[model samples]
Target: TQLLEQSPQFLSIQEGENLTVYCNSSSVFSSLQWYRQEPGEGPVLLVTVVTGGEVKKLKRLTFQFGDARKDSSLHITAAQPGDTGLYLCAGRPGNQGGKLIFGQGTELSVKP
Candidate 1:
């Protein structure tokens, strides 16, 4: 069984604060993806990292994949109230029938 563990299960921060959370696993994955979901809506894909040591950025969010492909990190800079949402990490195991393994998820709240 493959499991992805996300850190800081819950976060509450003031606007303009920066934060970084992580997803880790013992198993190496073929690919990893990040998603952000607001209440009453489906999760929206943020970014996908397929190569080891790959890094991608979208607006104020930055994502990095571990060199070993077994971990990932997300960093948000100068967060705003609108950034409040549930962040999730999903991984596709190497040759595992195409099923994605999900992390426990991190809930973030940014207050003005």
Candidate 2:
């Protein structure tokens, strides 16, 4: 079984602070996806990194896939109150018929 673990299960910071969330696993993945979920809504796809060492950015959010494809990180610069939400990392195991194995998720609170 593949499992992705996220560090700092919960985080609270003031607005304008910077933060980084990590997802790690011992198994290799074909691809990894990051999503953001707001209260009362389903998660929204933020980005997918298919290549090892690949990185993608959306506004102030940056996502990076590890060189071994077994880990990933998300960095938020100048975080704002609106950025407070639940962040998830899902990996597609190469041998698992492309099904996504999700991490426990990180809950962030950015207060003004």
**In candidate 2, which residue pairs clash?**
none
Computed on alpha carbons, the lDDT of every model, listed in order, comes to 0.97, 0.96
Per-candidate TM vs. native?
0.98, 0.98
Q: In candidate 2, which residue ranges exceed 4 Å CA deviation? A: none
Decoy 1 TM-score against native: 0.98
Candidate 1 local lDDT, 45-71, one digit each (tens): 999999999999999999999999999
What's the lDDT for residue 48 in model 2? 96
Where model 1 places Cα greater than 4 Å from the true spot, the runs are none
